[model samples]
Target: MNGAFSLLIPVYRGDDPAHFAKAFSSSVGEQTVKPAQVVLVQDGPVGDVLAAAIDHAVESSPVPVTRHRIEDNVGLARALDVGLTLCEHEIVARMDADDISLPERFARQLPVVEGGVDLVGTGMFEFLDDGGAIVARRVPRTGHDEISRYARFHDPFSHPTVMYRRSAVQRAGGYQPLGLMEDYWLFARMIDAGASVENIPDPLVMYRVGAGAYARRGGQAQWRSELELQRALRRIRFTSRWEYVRNVSVRGVYRFVPEGVRKIAYRRLIAKG
Candidate 1:
C-alpha cells in the first residue's frame, strides 16, 4: 500500500499476447508517475506456454513486475478476489489482458483522487474487430450522489478502465465471484457501500469488443445475468416489471443487432476517433 500505483492484470489466457505487452508499454512504461508494482495474475489454470509467455513479458516490463499463476480455472471474479488481496500499493489500477491503456492513463487519474472519491474511471476508445474499428468513445460520469441516486439504473464506469484505492476496496469487503461480468457486481456493491465514484471525461484506454462477447452474453446466459442485474437493481430502488423489460430490451438491442450494421451505426453515430 505504498506505491504511487500498481497495475493488476487478471488473465484467463484468451487475451492477445501482443496486447498484453502493449498495455504495459503504453501504460506502465510511459507514465511519468510510475506504479511501484506491476503484477499479472493468471486466473485460469496455467499451462507451459502461458506461463512462459507471462514470464517473458514480465522480464522486460518497465515497472517492477511480478507474476502469480492460479492452479485452476476459477473464473475472473475469483481471480480479482485474489488479486485485490495481493495488491500491495495505495492505488490499484485494473488492466485487461487485451486492451491498451494510454500513456497518461494513471498520471491523469492519480492527481484527481484527492477528497473522498474511492474510485475513478475514464473514457475509452473501442479497439474492437475489423468490422467496427472502434465504437463510440465512452466517457462515464458519476459522483457519489449521482451514483447512489441511479444505482438501480446502470453501471457508471467501464469496469476495466478504472483505478481504485486498495484501502477503500478492502473496507468495502473486497470482490466476490459475480460470474462472467464481475466488475458489474463490484461497482454496484461499491455504490451500495457509500463509496464515491466518477469517470474522467478523457479517453484514457482502448477497450476491445469482439463477436464472441455477443455470443456468450446474448443467449440464455445473458438472460440469467439480466435476472442478476434486475436483482441488483432492486437493491437500490423498486423498478416496475415493465421498467425491467424496457431496460432489458434496450440493452438487448445493442447486443442483438446484426454485427455488420451495428458496427457501422456505432462508428458513424458514436465513434469519436
Candidate 2:
C-alpha cells in the first residue's frame, strides 16, 4: 500500500482482445492499491479490434499504461521475460489477459511482499466464461517450507495470482521457454535457489476457465512438457528419484485419462476451492 507495484500482463493474438482489455482495465481500476504503471506486452500481430482495445485501455486508465509490442508471436514465457524487463517497479504483479483480479488483491499481496516474501500468490476462484458462474476454487500451499515441499510434485502457487520481487526472478534467471509449464519451471528453480515464497489463504482473483481448459492440459504435447519439467526438477534435486517417478506416473494418468474423468479430477481432486 505504501509502495507502488507494476502490473505485468502479456497479450497475444489468440486472446479475445476486447474481453481481455475490458477485464484487465476494470480489474486494475478497481484495485484498492493502484499500480504506478501497467505494462501490457503484445506478443504478436493482433487484429484491428484487439489493437484498438489495447489502445482504449491505455488511454482510459487512471494510471499510466505502457505498451510493448513484439515483432512476432513469441509465446508466453518469452513475452513475460520481455515484459518483466519493462516493469518500472521492483515489485511486479502478474496478471493474465483474461483473468479478473479482485479489488483487494494488491492490497493483500503488497503487505506480504513488503514483509520480505520474495514471491506471494493467493488462492483463486475459478469461474466460467464471462464469470457468470463459479466452477471451482484453487487453494495453493502456503509458507516457504510447505511450498518448497509441494513444488516437488505440483505447482505450489497460482501463476496469475502471484506478486514477485523482480530481483528474485532475475536471480533465478527469469522465465524460460517451457511451453505451458513455464511458470512451474521458474517457480521450481526459485524454490531451489531458496527464495522465500508464500501464499495468501484467501482467494484474490477470479480465474476464467472455459470448457476446453482441461482438454488443453491434456494431449501428447502437454505430457512431454510435464515430463521435461519433472526431469528439470530431478536435476535440481527438487525431487528425489522416487518422487519424480511418482509425479510422472500420477501426471501421466491425468494426461491420458478420458476427458470426462479429467474434468471431474480437476474440479474435485485438483482444485480445492
Top-TM-score candidate index: 2
lDDT of 2 by residue, 51-121 (tens): 88888888889998889999999899999999999999999999998888889999999999999999999
lDDT of each: 0.71, 0.88
Q: What TM-score would you give candidate 2 relative to the actual structure?
A: 0.96
Give one digit per residue, the lDDT tens place, for model 1 in 31-126: 777778887788766556656667777887767877777888887877777877777777889988778787788878886665456898898887
Among these predictions, the greatest lDDT belongs to 2
Worst 10 residues of 2 by lDDT: 18-27
Clashing pairs in 1: 1-88
Q: In candidate 1, which residue ranges exceed 4 Å CA deviation?
A: 1-3, 47-49, 129-133, 212-217, 235-273
User: How many residue pairs clash (N, CA or C atoms closer than 3 angstroms) in each of the candidate models, in the order given?
Assistant: 1, 1
Q: Could you tell me how far off, in angstroms, the CA of residue 135 lies in candidate 2 after the best superposition?
A: 1.2
